[model samples]
Target: MAVNPPKIKVLLSANERLQKLKEAFHGKYKESPLFYACAPGRVNLIGEHIDYCGYAVLPMAIEQNILAAVSVNSSQTIQLANTDPKYKDFTVSVNEITIDRENPQWHYYFLCGVKGVQEQLGLSSMTGISCVVDGTIPASSGLSSSSALVCCAGLVTMEANQKTISKVLLAETCAKCERYIGTEGGGMDQSISFLAEEGTAKLIEFNPLRATDVKLPEGAVFVIANSCVEMNKAASSHFNIRVVECRIATKVLAKARGLEWSSLQKLGDLQTALGLSLEKMLDLVEEVLHPEPYSREEICKILGITTEQLSKNILSANTHHNLICRPCVS
Candidate 1:
């Protein structure tokens, strides 16, 4: 049985935006869009960069989002056009979708989501699509614009294939597929984007992957200011380096406690094994993992794994450049 997504109520303002998107799609594709998919950008008010380590994140979807108007085609080719002229149009065969990490274009991010849903549904070939993507989120401003794009693409693909999926399932699939673009995120962005309810924030937890609504204080107004600078997390090695640091720290902590640490990839897994709270986990980090940077040889000695195994298993492509890993406890 095909599961249905949660009922979404579009307000007058959102309806106007959809109408504009529909008109834009017709202008570009010379045909009306069958349906529109939207995924909002997110703001992580408290948690930062810990989601990939299997930690809970408190996030909320912002008003800005990536919206896509799509129509299915019989051309066996996926055609993409952007409402923004800066992003050039792209078309590819249904069976040939390639996401380039080196030169990460706007279209490649959309393809990441489409390819993700395609792979998740086990479809060897996908139906051709004509899509016009529009977004208001500031690119690379740490507000999950890329993740929103991926989520939007995933939804478009699912609807185009005539498959129904729950918001939770779509969020999970989109999160996993985002790794195709070389950013190993913790899934909070996509989760809140899909699972968010209007007028409330969400406490997004991982591993089991659930969300609980968090009410805000009455009359509290939050403001977000962009620095007008951009950092592509996938293009840079900084984000992955932190992930590697945490992994090494987990293995070292696990090895110290006399628990088999090889299988422990997440700090949350270590916390579960020790039955420790977040405070206790911080205490454990100070006790076991030192502040000094750990070299490749030192980490290998502690984990009893060779340098080759370390590179293959623990370190990602970006982390290989930095052999000295620091435990980012503070």
Candidate 2:
């Protein structure tokens, strides 16, 4: 017998908040004034550290998503509420592009989207909005909860303003706004979240900002086991470090070969240009750096390196806990 994978869904129960939201705007306008939009969270299957370097990444939008409830207000102040009452309401002006420090820690991300949209359309002022946001996307799990939230907010705001908003523009606005969160991500999450089709993976090429949808193989199940280790893109400098390291490596390799790094179109091209196998590249890296590469005790003995040095280098590289490889889903 074939085993079934676990299914997850957003479960919103009938409660006081739901009743109040319905009552607040049931017949307020001439037509149905309520607007709803969904934005999905993204999962990166491979190409983790290569996005900023203009490499191809494979990602998919999961079932987890953010659903937004929005209504336009006559005033110039935007008001937002979360399902968790402890999370304070966020209020900001359409004219003022300032960061909210008190309420949601991800407020900067939203502010970025709002400002981006305003700048994109040359809109001097946006109508005030009352929005209630709820989502099933896991926060701080390497899944793109922040991007989904920003995309959902942007969509509602655009709809409320009666403007034509393209998905490409929405993704760009969300990614640009998320920079306020203090992490320099390459816009993969927002792009994938907005454009990804269900049951398909997207291959995104950075710099030029192109996406290709690739269907997943039939009868294949994707198992995403969270190691319970979470890394915050904004709070941690680790992601940036990996980006810089890859750039440095690329530049060094290019200079050694008397060629520009931009000329190399693919990662495999870089390896071929350097005439180095993956193991040989690792060995060269060990030689260039002070300590040797990561190796088990027996492997170190075979390579004639001291175990202590090998262990220390491995720790420095954080190889022990890294998500090294993932199977191709498309």
Candidate 3:
């Protein structure tokens, strides 16, 4: 989670993308970048969904990554520009680094990372930097592109500020900061991005934030083809709806057994509280919950709470805003 060592001219010549990004930084800011930071996009080989549910996820870092060429500045403003013209440039004062959750722009994701690092280090005055970003990962393709960008930004901020932190802490901070953009991630993307070693995949688990190496079969290749279908998880409700559904389902099950349901969120945590095996959890799901979608009223009634109470208990802010029939205000 520190600055990548300065690449000599020959090494820069060897890596075209790095060379190009360095040139882009010079072109945009008219100054040589001090250093570069990069974090790779990851594709989950298995269990992407269960990561947020307190389960381990298997992901491998892809070559495609978000790269930033950065130079510390005395201007007191963090400026960002992307190699891709479609992503417009952004600038914000170091003291006013705020994330706009309502608008999940590309820059907000980067800001999420910067803000995370700033908060973690408790830096009263952060070092402003001029950054030119380049990314090869396809956005909205389930390749963890946004998370990679956040990780890269966090790493860059740490370096620019001359701060030091462990890779695990950096990963955890990035994962939490992404919530500023209104995505509740389970750390698979950030964890794999930071902890991945070349030639090996990782099984990422949270709570303690540990990674276990998973050796793939020799000569195995994972080819990912994008259909070009695009949906920003932060901008769309489809992703968070599933998260909310899981939260409500966990609470529903907890309430059915007379447990303090509001405190429960993930199904895994609920099962842990009940001390039930996966088999018993399945049986409990069968006995307590239904296959079909439950109406807002039905959900409230099942939890023995009012619509307002249910609304407060069952959702994160971003997920709550997406509810079709938002609980009525009295």
Estimate TM-scores for all models.
0.94, 0.68, 0.93
lDDT per residue for candidate 2 within 184-289, as digits (tens), equals 5668888887778777898987555677878899988988777767666666556644543454345445544576654453344566677777677656545443
Off by over 4 Å in 3: 1-10, 321-330
Worst 10 residues of 2 by lDDT: 1-10
**What order do you get sorting by lDDT, best first?**
1, 3, 2
Backbone clash total for model 1 is: 0
Summarize candidate 3's per-residue lDDT along 1-330 as a digit string, tens digits.
232323334478888888899899999999888888889999889885787778778899999999899999789999999999999999999988888888899999999999999999999998789999999999999898999999999989999989888888888899999999889877889988988988888888777889888999999988888999988999977777777777777877888899988778788798789999988987887887766657877887777788777667666666665543321100
Model 3 TM-score? 0.93
Candidate 2 local distance difference test against the native:
0.62
Q: By lDDT, who's the top model here?
A: 1
Q: Comparing candidate 1 with candidate 2, which one achieves the higher TM-score?
A: 1
Q: Residue 230 of model 1: what lDDT?
A: 93
lDDT of 1: 0.86
Indicate the residue-level lDDT of 239 in model 1: 78
List candidate 1 segments past 4 Å from native. Answer: 1-3, 6-16
lDDT of each: 0.86, 0.62, 0.84
The RMSD of every model to the true structure, in order and in angstroms, is: 2.3, 10.3, 3.9
